[model samples]
Target chain A: MLKVENINMSYGDLQVLWDVSFEVNEGEIVVLVGANGAGKSSILKTISGLQKVSSGKIKFDNDDLTIIDPAEIIKKGVVHVPEARRLFNEMTVEENLIMGSLHGEAKEKRNETIKKCYDLFPRLKERQKQAAGTLSGGEQQMVAVARGLMSLPKLLMLDEPSLGLAPVLVQDIFDIIKGIRQQGITVLLVEQNVQTTLKFCDRAYVLENGKITLEGTGKDLLNNEHVREAYLGI
Target chain B: MDLFLQSLVSGLLIGGLYAIIGIGMTLIMGVLKIINLAHGQILMVAMYITWVLWHTWGLDPYLSIFITIPLVFVFAEGLSKYLLHPLIEKDSILPENQVLMTVGIGMVLVELARSIFTSDYRSIQTSYTDKSLYIGNISLSLPLVIAFIIAIILTVGLFYLLAKTDLGRSIRATAQDKFSATLMGISAAKITILTYGLGSALDAAAGSLLLPVYYLYPDVGPLFTVKAFVITILGGLGSTVGAIAGGLVLGIAETFGATYISSGYRDATGLVIFLIVLVFFPGGLKRFTKV
Candidate 1:
């Protein structure tokens, strides 16, 4: 239920996203696979209102996402779990989760929502009192995801949730994403782990040099020769 | 030994007030990541407000905190939201433009106070102004003891707010990661303004408390601004707990210096300790406490 139309984004004079457009229907796990500097992160950033597009529009379930504040975008039920997990390192894990649901309905259901998050990642419940920075990378990722869920969003956009995790932990994170989808929450994931992400994602887009070069079902792209050679390295 | 005990007691008492001021600066510094050159100026204005309340209505300096806090909070909020926040949005060549703007704000505040108050040193006399409480060899100023008790209450209250309240969590979160805070629907701009207002409110409380025990003028803010930053650095940048310790350390050092060494070297004593702390404990007391 999200549409990004012909968005051109830049940093100063250097343009990073040129006429990039994509869509994710409700309840789907959409993945954007690209190499470093391919503008995958930039697209997510623009959608979340962290960076504004110079041209074109972003419409989310009929709301004009382009013209609103970033905080307002979250209120519209679109939450972004940014790259690097970005947990408030100094704050306790529970405190970090509390930060995620600071407005409206999410805030009202804060205690209940936190209980749900802890149930999703019981390990976080165990380390609830510990500072977020002290957690393992896997645990920190869980906090980041759990924190995102705390927002009670219709759509959760995650950027590189498995970036620094161990191989085993990476699979676990992928499984968590699937579990999230099963809970009726839509996910838009940006990842460099093409083979793994492609296997699980409902649909996938191939971004190269600020452009969406290809889009298809996950299985379609996995079997495509260009995708195998360029991304999966198969 | 009696003299030493006396200075130590008095130093600890005064340090409580200093901690309040430092805590305010630390909150602003932690969230906005600016030096806040106008911090002491805000306190100065609060003192003047307190002075006016006393001079006009004969309100006790202690009772004036309620009025001064909300007044300074709104004024400081406007300063941060209108003056500093906009500068951050602009594409300035120097990233320090926001900081420079605070310096300008401080100048304006000082000038405004000068125009109105005319640089005159003003002090208030209450029933307890000259009274002291004697504990055998040590005598404590009554006003200072009351300020100290109030300072303790306020510090505890602030700690509770930061540790338990949602607004405090948003503040700490924004201080830690502004982008992430926004993604979580915590408006960093509003948080910044709130933090500035909260910080100034604490400063106002300190100013009101200090009125019965100290003299104030338009130029009084610069000295306290230096002290606030020194306390901020001493306590460790952005650590509320550290600010308290930093303020106490400074208060004790200055008092001891005045007692043992030449009284003229009291301010210099705090500077010496500040430099030493910068060199040895660059992380401030946070390095030790990890708070």
Candidate 2:
């Protein structure tokens, strides 16, 4: 479980996130839907300890992650898959996954986890020896997600996993996300594609201009007049 | 033809040592993405440590490697932790503050060596220094041959570290994307410190290997600094494989230039090749290996 309480974040003089709060129970897939520059990514960054929070607490299963280092945050079983699927481009697909298991218990179970990842993405298994940068967008996204899984995370945060993928590939990626939750791993996803994300996620939150504007069950938000008008473009 | 063969052989032997030096610089550049301008000075410092050990304790230059490496590793680690890492967080007018800091560090190292050891040229006298092994009419300097073998072994060891080890994975990950590496539980700060130390240790090995044939003085650092930069650029900014090729190419080019042209043009030869590589193969040997 993860709880983000009234976190305020800024970039130098520019305030990007204002009193944004959200929560995700164990094994739940929570989606944060917002327009471009609506601070969706910023919220994830703040939670992952990549961006410094001006005020607020990010607690995961009673452990304070707000002031901890990103590496330490990860060791606590919180893995963040950043936007654009920032895989180690020059490294082999296998090496990129190996990087995921660089510390703690993940290092011990690296080979096993890698096997599991390969099984999950059989296409990745075929291209294991190839450089990640040489892969197609869909394959690269698969490598990114596989890499995140390699860390044996309790909570996995993904930022726009379907950002640049084709429509068909986006569906495959979403299916993978659903599969991941079925594996009993909690997921916090930020997406610009609202309709699909709301349909799949158990709970959803609407972030508008650095603040949480709406939060409810996925079905409730999906059918809300404001949500349909603003996000679903009904 | 004999002259060509001799020059080529000699160049390759020397290139092995140069490769060791270049690899150190490349590793540093790869992780920190900053040119360690003081690289040569660090080598110089290592050479001085080797010299002192050899002169005072009768330790063989090769034997002193074990001592010099760990010492330089600690020194460089401290330098990175206390000096360089702090500057990374500070806002600067120029983006190249780190590179400029290395220049300043180089100057300080040179001055420190000069103050302590003075400007006198020094060289180690080992029995194998002048001995050579013959293969037909061509001969290989015994010390150089040994140095070359050691260099190759060290390089192979470095490759293993980068490819097979967890630390290596974290380092490569950090080089690719620092933020992402952190998310994977790699402490970028720790990796940077360790990388600086590792790079410095390699430089120490190079300095030790070169001590038998190369003369040492406070100003020796600049020449090497220039050579290491040339190799790093020629090999590709952060590619260890590229650095090795760059080192050999520069080595061969310099030797051939010295033999066919003039000894004075030996250094210029490397510079010329560096320019050619810059203009033609901007990615260095890394463009070839794609690693």
Top lDDT prediction, candidate number: 1
- Candidate 1 per-residue C-alpha lDDT over A54-153 given as tens digits, one digit per residue, 9 for 90 to 100: 9999999989798998888888999898899999999999999988888899999999999999988999999999999999999999999999999899
List interface RMSDs for the candidates, in order: 0.8, 0.9
Model 1 lDDT tens row, B24-54: 9999998999888888899999999999999
Once superposed on the true structure, which residue ranges of model 2 sit more than 4 Å away at CA? none
Off by over 4 Å in 1: none
lDDT of 1: 0.93
* lDDT for A203 (candidate 1): 97
Top DockQ: which candidate number? 2
Predicted candidate 2 versus true structure: per-residue lDDT over B65-94, tens digit per residue: 899999999999999998899988999899
| TM-score of every model versus the real structure | 0.98, 0.98
